[model samples]
Structure formats: C-alpha cells, structure tokens
Target: MAFLLLGFALVMVGASGIRPCNLAFGADQFNPNTKSGKRGINSFFNWYFFTLTFAVMVSLTAVVYVQSNVSWAIGLLIPAMIMLISCAFFFLGTNIYVKVKPEGSPLTSVVQVFVVAAKKRRLVLPEQPWLTLFNYMPPKSINSKRPYT
Candidate 1:
C-alpha cells in the first residue's frame, strides 16, 4: 500500500513537471510573427490537444478494460513500453530539436522588484515623473563579472 501511494505521488510530481515544459517546448517550435508561423502554431496546438484527448479517452476505456478484464500485467506493460518507445524517439531526434539554454530563475527578478518597491515605498515622488524613471537596459552576458543593475 505504501509503495502504491509512493508510485502515485511520483507520477503526480512527474506529470506536473512535464505538463508545462511539454506545452512550452512544443509551442517554442514555431515563431508566431509571420502568417504561416501563426497558422502553424494554431494547427500545432489544435492537433496537440486533439491527440491528448484521444489518448486519454482510449486509455480510460480500452486500457481500463484490459486491466480489469484481461491481464493486469499486460495492461501495465503496454503503457510502460509506449513510454519507452516515446523516450527512444525523443532522444533519436535530439539533434533536430531546438535546444534552448536555461536562463536564471525568473522568480528572483520578481522578488527583487518587490523588495525594491518595499524599500522605496516611503520615498517622495519628484515633481516630474520622468525624473524618477530609468531607461530599460538589457542584462549583461552570463560570463560578465559585473552584477545586473
């Protein structure tokens, strides 16, 4: 029973981690600026959802039936084998995929903004609003020794 619960928890965690990354990764494949890119993105999402729904429906109906009526071992093995094949295909196409390098955590910037706002909360505004505003500057490269302003 404990092992079963642990398996469920692991599955929940894995699914949660994969769901956002999968959607973002798929959407990142297309540039939505051009007309064809826009159409491609739309079509990609439509097909993605359609296939997802179909898989869920089939799994719930057919897989459940197999597990309940047929051999449970075979039913369980089916998804495991499918997942193995999926991973194999993904790794095989690694060279063709658009691999984006990881940027620093976005949450840090959000926290910094809130901290700065709290620190400056008591400050008086200048007569001219423009005087208080600063121009947007891009962050320096990762290799730079200088800290982000």
Candidate 2:
C-alpha cells in the first residue's frame, strides 16, 4: 500500500504541469464572452473533469481487480492503455486548442503596466514612512501610484 501511494503521488506530481496547460487550451476554443460560446466552454469542462474522474475511477478499479484476480502486469497495463489513449486524444485535438498570440507575455505585460503608470507623474505614490521619518522624500511631487506596487 505504501508503494502504491508513493506511486500515486509520483504520477500526480508528474501530471500537474500538463493538466493546466491542456485544460486552458481546451476551454480556449470557446469565446466565453458570448452566450453560446460560454455555454460550449462550460459543457467542455463539464465533460472534461467528469471524464477525468471517470478515468481515475476506472483505473483504480482495474488496479484493485488486477491485484485480486489478474496477473500484476495485465492489470497495470489496462490503465496504462487508458493514459495512452488520453494522450492520443490530446495530440489529435491539439490543432483545435486555443492559443495566445502574445506568447507567454503576461508577466511582461503586468510589469509594463506598472512601469507606464510610474513614468506618468500623474498619480499618488505610496509613501514610505521610513523615508518620511528620515526626510528622504524626492524633490518632485511624488506621483507614484502604481497598481502593481
């Protein structure tokens, strides 16, 4: 049982990175801003996580059955096949996945927002009490209200 649990942990952690990327890509196929598209995306996820849970349950059942009645290799391979099938589906549907044009620029965009706001001397900057106590204020009117700050 310890070995089985440790194996489960390993599989989960290994799968964690790919799960978000796949779900977001799949859901991206729908433009949730529209009513129909929103409904379609909602349907996609309803099927998505349900299928995920169903697969897990089926795999667990296979493992238990294998442990009890079948040869170890045969039992393990059943769920292994399921994983292979799931991977194939993902690959086959890859072309339909939603993609980002800016290509992983979210952080860059966020930082730029702050930089642009800070550059425009038009907002209230957050005050550092230490600076005020030490009399370290800059000469110009401190307009440093950055949302990212």
Candidate 3:
C-alpha cells in the first residue's frame, strides 16, 4: 500500500511539472503575431492532441494484452524501454530546440502590471514611444525585414 501511494505521488509530481511546460514549449516554436506562426501553432496543437490520444490508445491495448497473455514483467519492461528510447531521442534533439529561460512567476508580473497602472493613473502618458513607462520594442526593430540603421 505504501509503495502504491509512493508511485501515485511520483506520477502526480511528474505530471504537474510537465503539463504546464509542454504547452508553452510547443507554442514557443512559432511567433503568435504572424500569419504563418498562427497557422503553425494551430496545426501544432491539433497534431499534438491527436498524437497523445493515439499513443494512449495504443499503450492501453498493447500493455493489457502483454500483461494478460505473456508476463507482467515483460509488460512493464516494454514501457520502460520505450521511455528510455524517447528520452534518448529528446536529448539528441536538444540542440535543435528553441529554449526559453524561466522568467519570474507569471502571476507576479501580472500583478505588477496592475499595480503600475493604478499608480500611474494620474500621470499623462508620453506622446513619444521611447518615453513610455512600459518598455516595449516595436516588432520592426526585431524582425529581419527591417535592418537596424
């Protein structure tokens, strides 16, 4: 019973960590503003869910069949081997992945925005873009089409 509880706790922790990160990592692959980027993200989500559903179906049927017909040990071994192979493939593709650094808690930043807005409510905003309180660089400054002078 203790071992079963421990396994459940570990699975919960792993799922909690991965669930929040997977969507952000996948979405980071394309810029959200551009047409192509929008399409890319949309297609990515569609395919991602489809693949997940398919994998779950396959794993359920295969694992159950193996456990019932062959041996419980071999059934468990199959998933362990698959996880090892998947991890290897993930590490191999690390160089090709777009890595995003962890910014401080997103909730903190959102609260900060609200606080800043309230504090600055009386102050008139500047007409000049550079003088604005919020530091946002225009897309033209970053995009490749318009090279910086």
Candidate 4:
C-alpha cells in the first residue's frame, strides 16, 4: 500500500512537470511566422489534442473495464506497455527533432540580484531613489527579429 501511494505521488509530480512543457516543446518545432509553419503548428495541435482526448476516453472506459473484469496486474501492464512503445517511437525520431540550446537559468540571475541587494544594504539612498537607477538602451545595430524584442 505504501509503495502504491509513493508510486502515485511520483507519477503526479512527473505529470505536473511535463504536461505544461509538452505543448510548448511540440510547437517549438515549427517557425510560426511563415504560412506553412503556422499551418503545421495548427495541424500539430489539432492532432495532439484529438489523440490526447481519445487516449483519455479509452483509458477511462477500456482500462477501467479491464481492471474490474480481468487481473489487476494485466490492466496496469497494458498502459505500461503502451507507454514503453510511445517512448520508443519518440527516441526513434531523435535525429529529426529540433534541438534548442538553453539560455542561462533565470533563477541564477534572480539569486545574483538578491545577493547584490543584500551587499548594498548599508549604502545611503538619495531623496529620489528612482533617479539613481540605471536604464539600459541597446544600440540600433543590434536589432532582433524576434517579436518579443
């Protein structure tokens, strides 16, 4: 019973972490700016959602029926085997997938800001604190094509 609960907790944690990132990761494969890219992304999402809904319906109905009527171990094994095959398919497409290089961690930059603030706590502040703050302006030559920029 303890092991079952522990397994359930782990699965919940894993699902929580992966679920949000899954859509973003899939969408990242296409360049959304181009017409074909936009169409591909839309199609990808449509199929992705349809399959997701279908899987849930099957799991709820078929898996539940199997668990109630057949051996509990076999019912659990069915999903496990499906998961294994899906994992295999994912790995097989590794060469074709777009590999994005990760930027530096945001948490590290946040920690550095906190550490700098703590070290500067003894400094005296001016009457207008906002005036003392530095604002960065980038050069026009370094333009970014990204929409966020």
Q: Top model by TM-score, which number?
A: 1
Q: For candidate 4, lDDT tens digit of each residue in 8-113?
A: 9999999999998788779889988899999999999999999999999999999989999997898999999999999999999999997666666767767878
At residue 12, candidate 2 shows an lDDT of: 97
lDDT of 1 by residue, 59-119 (tens): 9998899999999998998888989999999999888877566576777878978998999
Off by over 4 Å in 3: 106-149
Candidate 1, which segments miss by more than 4 Å at Cα?
A: 109-149
Tens-place lDDT digits, model 3, residues 1-149: 99999999999999999987888788888887999999999999999899889889978999989999999999999989988998999899989888766645767767877998999889876788576656766766634342211
Question: Model 1: which residue pairs collide?
Answer: none
Regions more than 4 Å wrong, model 2: 1-13, 102-149
Measured by lDDT, the strongest candidate is 4
lDDT of each: 0.81, 0.76, 0.84, 0.85
- Indicate the TM-score of model 4: 0.68
Point out the worst 10-residue segment of candidate 2 by lDDT.
Answer: 140-149
62: Cα error in model 1, Å: 0.8
Residues 1-149 of candidate 2 have per-residue lDDT tens digits of 99999999998998897877767777768987799998998899999999889878977786888867979888878777877997999789777666654444467868977998889868665586565556665667344432221
Stretches of candidate 4 off by over 4 Å are 1-4, 108-149
True-structure RMSD for candidate 2: 11.2
Better by lDDT, candidate 2 or 1 = 1
